[model samples]
Target: MADKIRVLLAEDEPSLAFIIKESLETRDFLVSIYGDGEEALAGYRKDSPQILILDVMMPKKDGFTLAKEIRLSDRNTPIIFLTAKSQTSDVVEGFQHGGNDYLKKPFSMEELIVRVHALLNRLELPVNHKEGIAIGQYVFNYTRQSLKFNEEEEQLTHREAEVLLHLYKSRNEVVDKSVLLKELWGDDDFFSGRSLDVFITKLRKKLTKDDKVLIVNSRGYGYKLLC
Candidate 1:
């Protein structure tokens, strides 16, 4: 039989952690819980979980630090940060530090489960590209989550890759902001809308090497990727 999908979860709150573990277990996932970032790091090295869910605030080390450290050696494993931070800058930091996705505190178990399945499905899917799609002077490798421009390359988080792929599919046309939020984030609430803006800002910076590439905002409506 196939091995159960392993999940390494690090969160200090026992009640929340328990709920997450129990929920994932019900779906046939094997979850190992750690109460601190340091412990989680050690556990990750020893057990090699297929995915990681880390709380942003934990003893010994924070989620951003843990993610950055893990990324020094491992880049493919998906990471989802659980944050209570409300600031947009905090979310940006999480993404910059190698987190592929995030869940705000008080998130639904169903949503968490769905995100888990989505990330795992991405890992299991067949290779997306051998050559990659061209966007202006850049080559986007969806499977690798990378965008290359000449000698430089921008490594994208899972969320960023997914966002870029959606825009790429409908390049030069306006893709409604609400559609992006609903499709990628499961809702178009205020928080989700702000998060989407943050991602677009990051993507724009990465593609700045070529002036021909632009992710244009459509005046409170949507965005158009002109390349």
Candidate 2:
């Protein structure tokens, strides 16, 4: 049997944290729980879990502080913020402190699972140069910043590549516009919002050859890449 993946979960709400821990354990994850960020950080230093699920607002230290402390020594471990903060600034701060992903409160278990797997995939894959990610008929080369479909190849700008990679990773699921803006642009200003629209249009045109692959606008909500 393979070893279970270790998870360190820190949240002040006992009931919610318990539910999350049990759910993850049932999925064969080895979960260690802490009620405060201080304890969580200590556990992280001692046990060194493969991933962290931290509440942004916790007693003592706080999730953002813990993340920064962890990153000071080890930047490889994936951190996911389980926060109630939906503000663009808060989300951006989460990323700046070394969070790979975040889930706002009142979230579904299914959503948590999807985000976890997405982060895990990036961690498990070899760094520096991955072969590519296949999206229907298109092959996206991350290192080369190019998308290829049959005989055609299109080069992508840095921002375009970043946006496309996020969409591709969360393919078939709607990713909130605010989430993308925070992760990529660091804020949800008017200019960045317009830029995202432009990038989406460019991506849609590039994948025109593949009828099964498309970036779908979720009508005032977000976008979903259907592949």
Candidate 3:
């Protein structure tokens, strides 16, 4: 049999955590469960699981902080944030802090399972190759999801890499706002649009090493990546 897919689950509520742990275990996953962010961080360091399901509210570090920490070292692992906060800003914050997906409180096991499988499928790109796309002063490796400038390397989330790659493909042209959103996020709705803005901001920051490289916004239409 294939090795069981490892999963790290950080949830503070004992009952809810138990439910999540047992559910994933039944699905042939080896789940390392932790009750707080700090413990979860340790579990992550030790297990290096393929998937991480983090509760937004936790003792010590919280899911957003934990995700940020993990992104610092491991950008490829998929993170699904569990939270009761439904505001658009909260959603943006989760994405800003490196969450790949967000699940609201009281979600169904079936939906969670589908999300887990979906992320695994979506983010299974090959990595660590040396080939890179020359983008001004930065070398962006889509496979590795990293942008390197001189000696420093900025790790990008899978979504960010995807967006950057897409923009690069159509550099110097205005990529329609709706088109980019629909292609990347599978939705061009207001919430997803907001998330896209956050990603664009992050990419702009990383590309700031070379001021000539810019993602210029075309009001009422789209964006153009000028390199």
The prediction achieving the highest TM-score against the true structure is 1
Whole-model lDDT, model 2: 0.82
Off by over 4 Å in 2: 127-227
What value does the lDDT take at residue 88 in candidate 1? 70
Among these predictions, the greatest lDDT belongs to 1
Candidate 3 lDDT, tens digit per residue, 152-223?
998887779878987987999999999988655546888898878988998988898898899999987988
Error of 3 at 212 (Å): 13
lDDT of 2 by residue, 1-227 (tens): 99998999999999998899888888898999999999998898888799899999999989999999887767667788988887867875776687767788898887787777766765554453367788898988865668999878897754566688888778899999999987665457675688689879988888899999989999978999999
Task: Pull out the clashing pairs in model 2.
Answer: none
Please report how far candidate 3 places residue 200 from its true position, in Å: 4.2
Over 4 Å off, model 1:
124-126, 157-159, 208-214
- As a whole number from 0 to 100, the lDDT of residue 31 in candidate 3 is 85
Q: Relative to the unseen true structure, what is the C-alpha lDDT of residue 48 in candidate 1, on a scale of 0 to 100?
A: 96
Cα lDDT listed for each candidate: 0.88, 0.82, 0.86
lDDT, residue 93, model 3:
84
TM-score of every candidate relative to the true structure: 0.81, 0.61, 0.72
